[model samples]
Target: MDKEVIGPGACVLRGFVDDPAEMVRAIADIAASAPFRHLSTPSGAPMRIAMTNCGRVGWVNVRSGYGYAEVDPLTGHSWPSMPAIFTRLATHAAAEAGFADYTPDVCLINRYTVGSSLHMHKDRNGFLKDMPVVSVSLGLPATFRFGGQGNGEPPRSIPLVNGDVVVWGGPSRMNYHGVLPLEAGVHPLTGNTRFNLTFRAGVVKPAPRLGSKTG
Candidate 1:
């Protein structure tokens, strides 16, 4: 796989997964256990993309707000365990991007169809802010908009195809990123859809407040 650096602490590993079919099968299993659903934003607006999770904790957005929960609100059960293939790929990809010893406890699976798009936002809920976010792309291609720390900053568009992996942390941890509206397309594995697996260290204890004492 060819590693292309996109920023100070971000990179794209082109064709990282040689056998995406294996990963696609695993994702099917995960979805069977935790079916994808559109999570509502704080404003009560339903997000365009459908999402699910597999790990110790899953990212959730409810009327209360966005945060990680140990159980799925929809099913009242723990999210499906993270599959070995998902964990292995995320760990190796993070290491390849310079973030070593990365073992993600949460894998957020996003399903995008034509017209589905994600708004630019920073990943700030995870307490392990030092760890990198390893994102793997599968199926139809999409344009990734990566921006600076500021909310109003214009973003640079990057095209990502199947098997592409993007990892970012350190200096670029809080940078804003999102996916543009997916266009019509069809792939052998996923048909007319796209899947994204975002691995994150979601089980860490919350960091102490600025003035809080720690041993």
Candidate 2:
């Protein structure tokens, strides 16, 4: 556990797990199943980032609105299962950040290119806000905005690179956080886009089988 406490309830772990390359491979396999798509917000503006997911559940938003879904709305199939490697990394990172027995059921895969950014927001789809979200960054580099727990507070920007893991929970669970627009670059392993895998405990319902159903 390469741990560094970056804030009151935020932390960064460099090379948090062994075999970072293998982790990227596993993520690729997962993405192959669901493929990546530029999702839309409730207001209709397309998200700056392209995304896909792997795990028991995938976070999605469509004409119906934002929520956890069993299938990828685009492929009409279930997203890939959360690989063991991902589960292990999440658990390890969580334990290092002082939360033990953390098993994440949802793995949100976000892809960012130059000028792609995520607005400050909170993760509220899960049951427990106190469980902490473990985010792993790979390929390229980006600035992460860390704001106070309140929505209106000004946020601090932190730079992140490949193999960097950030965890936020407890009082910081409600902290408003996001990624600033990424700069264009080539990461040997991931190329022009920044790959991020965020682990969270999703809802309990069973996810549909990929290639087996369509909405």
Candidate 3:
């Protein structure tokens, strides 16, 4: 795989996935247990992208706030167990990006179609900030915006295609980043859809059971 350094402690691994078809099948199985749904922001605006998760914990956002939850809010059950292939890819990608022994507890799967876009933002939830974030792209191609720590700096738009992986940590760990609106496209593996698998070290402590009182 070819590597391109986007910034300090950030890189893009071109065509990192050897078999996009296998990965797509895995995603379909994971989604079968934990189906994708649009999560709303704090203001109650539904995000354009449909999201789901697999692993010990899943990232969640509701009217109350955003954080990691041990259970799927929709089904009131634990998220599907992360597939072995997902863990292997994430750890290997993180290691290639200079973060060794990286083991993510959660994998957030984002589904985007034509016109779906994600606004620039920093990832600062309950996850361990020291760990690197590994993101894998599949299906249709899209533009990925990588920016600096401050908002004043203009972000660089990088074209990402199927099997491309991006990893960021250390100095670039908290940098602002997002994906631009997806233009019309049809990919053989996924038709008009694009799937992104984001791996992160989620909350260390187990979230309180739903509806349970906590201090």
Name the candidate that leads on lDDT: 3
lDDT of 2 at 62: 34
Could you tell me which residue pairs clash in candidate 3?
none
Global lDDT of each model? 0.86, 0.80, 0.88
**lDDT tens readout by residue for model 3, 1-215:** 99999998999999999888999999999888888888776566677899999999887763356667888887789899988899899999999999998888999999999999999999887788899999999999999999998958889999999999999999999999999999998999999999999999746664454332111
Best by TM-score: 3
Task: Sort by lDDT, best first.
Answer: 3, 1, 2
How well is each residue in 112-184 modelled by candidate 1, as lDDT tens digits? 9999999988998855789899999999999999989995767889999999999999999999999999999
> What digit string (tens of lDDT, one per residue) describes model 2 on residues 1-215?
55677677679897666776888898788877788777776666677788888876677763356666776777778788888889998998888888888899888889898998999888775446778899999889899998886746788888888889999887787788899889889999888988889898636554233221122
Better of 2 and 3 by lDDT: 3
Pairwise lDDT winner, candidates 1 and 2: 1
Q: Which ten residues in a row have the lowest lDDT in candidate 3?
A: 206-215
Candidate 3 RMSD computed on C-alpha atoms after optimal superposition onto the true structure = 3.2
Error of 3 at 52 (Å): 0.3
Please report how far candidate 1 places residue 62 from its true position, in Å. 3.7
Stretches of candidate 2 off by over 4 Å are 62-64, 151-153, 202-215
TM-score of 1: 0.92
Off by over 4 Å in 1: 151-153, 205-215
lDDT score, candidate 1, position 77? 83
